[model samples]
Target: MQDLTLVMAQLDPLVGDIPGNAERAIETVREARIEHKADIVVLPELFLTGYPPEDLLLRASMEARLEAARQRMADKVARDVMVIVGYPGRRDGGYYNLAGVLYNGDWLGEYAKQVLPNYQVFDERRYFTPGNRPLVIEHRGARLGVLICEDLWEGRPVHQAREAGADILVTLNASPYHQNKPAERLALFAERAREVQRPLVYVNQIGGQDELVFDGGSLVVDAQGELCVRAPHWQVGLMPVGFTHADGHWVPQAGECEPLAEAEDSLYCALVTGLRDYVNKSGFKGVVLGLSGGIDSALSLAIAVDALGPDRVQAVMMPYHYTADISQEDAAEQARMLGVNYEVMPIVSMVEACNETLAESFAGTPQDTTEENLQSRCRGVLLMAISNKKGLMVLTTGNKSEMAVGYATLYGDMVGGYNALKDVYKTWVYRLAKWRNTQDPVIPERVISRPPSAELAANQQDSDSLPHYDTLDAILERYIEDDMSAEAIIAAGFSEEEVYRVVRLVDRSEYKRRQAPVGVRVTSRGFGRDRRYPIVNGWQPGE
Candidate 1:
């Protein structure tokens, strides 16, 4: 029998903030050492440099800076308890998402990831060269095996670790949140534990990176494929797992944890956590958004205020000539109730000036979507101007529903630094708006009750340009996210014409979405790496 104490620190780390994340990880291990007197504190994947660094890993300076931080963290280790932390590793003419064991300024062992997921929101294949070995370390009179985020998912690492006579298996992850993902992870943990017949400890990072939110639902499983310790979903905390040998089988010690949320709430928390960390971690003083008095903007405002305090959020209403008075009132009222700074910038004059410049070429053309798009473009320019002048990032409020149908104007409503609801559907936009107002009156009922519109043209309800959400979302879910063919979607109670039209729109709009800012992905298939289509393909005309 081997005696060992392990601590799983479920932390939310910001992307690209090496020093800040390193400092917090070091502090967490120190505090946990004092509180639990643990032998080892395991941090989540990429804690030192934040998870899903995306393209940030391409820069050589980032690796140098992070190495400096890791060295600093090693110098501060003045206790018997060691730390197994994750970060990027640069060696052998390539980068690897690596993890290591630290004790008193010494690194005992290291492991690079064997599996680099390239599907869905992952782009690891675009970055690192996959590692090809097993890692097991001797510590505390017992043998310990380690794996990075995607390494544990591969069968080779687990089998090799077991072959190497590992007593306990530990893994670090930066897994993203999807609806019902926690449940699926738990099942995988159980199945994997049975295969290895060792106590498995999994620690995941929590926070939002671009359009992906990592839900920090870390957990521990026993040899019998049973969950002994589970961290609460979306919240950051630490859990202690003690392993005991019972009849040559690994048993786990229990502890308190936060409860995991379900479905919509879980998805919402991921967005909030992602937004909170991205804004706070990016070193921005605050956030600014253009509230259109519509559901998408309203929901985005709610998320921003919830993530970053209301004091840090600024809402501006740039109303155009066609913008109704009710729209202005709704946006203003919501901003006031949320206790955020509100500004009403009348864009009628600004838009008129721009239209005057283009009047000659558009003389014979009847008023159409292009003119309506001008209004949106004008508002986007003003918002961007504010973003630059104040050094504040503009949060775009476009939803997946509009992004799919090309209802949003490029360089207009879509011209912000971040898009909070980019992965959320218009139907969910309404649901989230109602759910948020239930928390308080930050959003007006008028925004929810009225017809969905752009307000760029007279009575320009979204319905006039596309199908109703009740119908459109169903078609999209079946045709897009669910990966159904056009004929298959028609079989799912949607009209053939509706299915064909929606699929056509999605195919044609890939170019626009390609340029759109990354958004939090709550669905299985967002308009991101998850669903890649050819923008120049000519197969859409029913060849």
Candidate 2:
């Protein structure tokens, strides 16, 4: 057995909670040193004040508090076990997200993240100035180079450290969860390990920060490009590994590599973890959502139950005069099957009051979309009331399809603390609903088969306002995600009429999407920080 142990503390941290996060970091480092007898403990990036602090990074007090907290943590570390952790550091008037090497409770080395990812749910460039150099620290007869997050994604930083005689490349990250992220990270680790001809330790943060969720699927790879130690996904735990000199090369001798999960299952877990963290991290214990007896609510309910357990999820069904009898039955059945708290609060009285106020303005206007919107807004108000009275964070159930085409009510179903599926499309919502049923049939067959309705008007089908989900999602993927022109989409086997309609809807609905709540991102181009379109545009496509 090797004389040294490497411990990866896959810890869950709260954003901007410097003191609490600092305490956790100290306690974990102590555990690794004393209990596991780790020679070095590697923690995730921004471990002291948490990951993607967003605007909170702008505050000057945050930097001071983080430094003070790191010093406090250094006091608890043992002499033999060198600790590598992350914090935001200010040097020469420019702030950088950095990682520090603490040996015998002293500073060994500091590495600043060079590449600040400014795209897709990340705006590091706005708050942080990139660090141009790399850090290699000496400990336990080995020189390990440290990189923070995006530094490993590129070739320069890792290459520079290797040129400086680094025996191993270690990266601290707050990489967000998306479909197939584990495989993607592992593939990168293997390539980088081979590039540097040294073993790699990829330590990533776990927990949710607003719309982004960091899956703790950290791993270690030997120079031979073989995975040795892999941590679990959507979890917070410590995995201890040891390296040995074999054939005059470093190789992991302890811990085991776990097989990666399937794409859909992993996406499901990401949403569950994100929602759970967002709710619990914000100091709320449970969630409340408006159950419209639609695919979005059903999927949201299943995700909620899976994340926080069914006991922590509450569903309220608001039926109106235009609401169908089957919808009421379906929602109740789905709620009962999921073993969640359900309430059927009829919104007839509330709608009546709203209409009485708007009677003068609506006297001559034949009941149109405006009347339908009033009902949706009324439900939003009711849910907000319930959410306020009871300390439950309302999980909005609007899907990406509805959000894209302005098919959703702004102040109605869109009113919530967070949206679990704002990034998921109507088609994916149906697929997830089907997947949920496979675990156990929580949703009724009729609910999935029937046409989607808002229940704001009598027998109002979604098809009246938007195209079929399959066709809509295809066009959306092309125009919004792929960033293709209207003409390019038309060339990709889509009709002139359907393609232009989707493009138009996407362009026109910027106001509605602007008012939408933050959601867990499962797709490559979700509406969170990844996709942003202009609300006021003058360009019109000629398709």
Candidate 3:
């Protein structure tokens, strides 16, 4: 039996930082060769240009720069170990997302990704032409196949590699995280391994890019569809997978398999990872948010502190006339407990100034939600001003439930560079607050248990204008996430009146959602990329 050691470099690459990323990849390759003494090193998808790259892929200069970096890497790579690297390939007036083999200081072969995912956070169809064939290489007495992220998911590339006599598969991925995505991926990997009957090494990138977080749960699966090695999620490191050649096929040696975190832990980790990367990668000195004592803002403060630590997070309680003593006290208590830079900026004066300015125009109009929204706007101004002056990113605290409806004030509470709970439902906000406290009681118990309110007007609870959170979230899950119609939702045991009201609110709020700050997406469908609805569409459900 032949023994081969493979190094999986689970790294976090900044998007569009070609030279920096290239240097990092080269160092990782050298480490795999010199330290691990590995026969092969596999990097994540688009390691050179970073995953998604977005509009940067449109630049011809980016391709040229990447090619130059590739040659620089080729000159430095040792002949004893082979490196499989992912880069953007430009040939014959077409761009292809590619993975190439570098060995003996030369390019062995390149495999263009066959599947260009277009759904949910992926828009590769807008850029590259899908590859038609799979590329497998003969290396060190072993037949190895290379597949990019989406290629493995489509199954054709893996099957094609198997047909081409590949004994072992190494797939590079920059897969983004959602709750329980690791479990789903492992299940899919097991199925794919059984189909190909070859040991597969899966290498994924770890870090947050904008609203997306890639959890690096890199692993190896045996031909029998059993997981052999699993790296820790949300971590960046070099993990080793050993393969032994037996009966003309490679079998993976058993190794470490980190236990999957529970639902709450995984979701919280995703939030923290996504927030941390966005703040750090974007070069923000720190983060600032208006911490109302409500669950949404309170939970957001906890997440920001956890992500960036106390010194990097600023919590400002902008209280108004309607803001209760309990709200101020709880906000202060949580801020003190978490050790964040806390301040109290009462918005009463700001609100009064705005109200006075609008008094002439609103003389005939009676007080409504508009007056209440001004309070939120006052807080928004203070938070954004601090963000601008201190070079700290403003963290919007609105949750998915409020954002789904028109409950949040646009340019008011919605003002922020990022939202930690953008995809989290209101009910989940309470649950997360409670869960976070279990780690440590930073969040006040009253903050989690109190009836949620905006405190914008007198006795203005969330239920004053909308249905209870339990009913609202359930209806929203069916409508927004599951794509169920209002009639169908009502059939799912919801009241007909509540169903239509929630659906209408969700429909009308599309414009607001479009302008809302991007946040960590813990659910399958988030407001940002996963679900796209036309703001002016007249199509109503069950019409």
Alpha-carbon shift of residue 96 in model 2 (angstroms): 2.1
Provide the TM-score for each candidate, comma-separated: 0.92, 0.95, 0.98
- Writing each residue's lDDT as its tens digit, candidate 2 over 235-310 gives 7888888877667566777477767876667777788888988888788869999887877788888899988999
lDDT of each: 0.82, 0.84, 0.88
Greater lDDT among 1 and 2 belongs to 2
RMSD of 2: 1.9
Worst 10 residues of 3 by lDDT: 534-543
Clash numbers, per candidate: 3, 0, 0
Q: lDDT tens digits, residues 443-529, model 1?
A: 899999999888877777888879999899988887678777888777767888878888898888889999998777888888887
For model 3, what is the alpha-carbon lDDT of residue 1? Answer: 45
Worst 10 residues of 1 by lDDT: 255-264
Off by over 4 Å in 2: none
Record all residue pairs in model 3 with backbone atoms less than 3 Å apart, i.e. clashing: none
Evaluated at residue 269, the lDDT of candidate 1 is: 81
Best by TM-score: 3
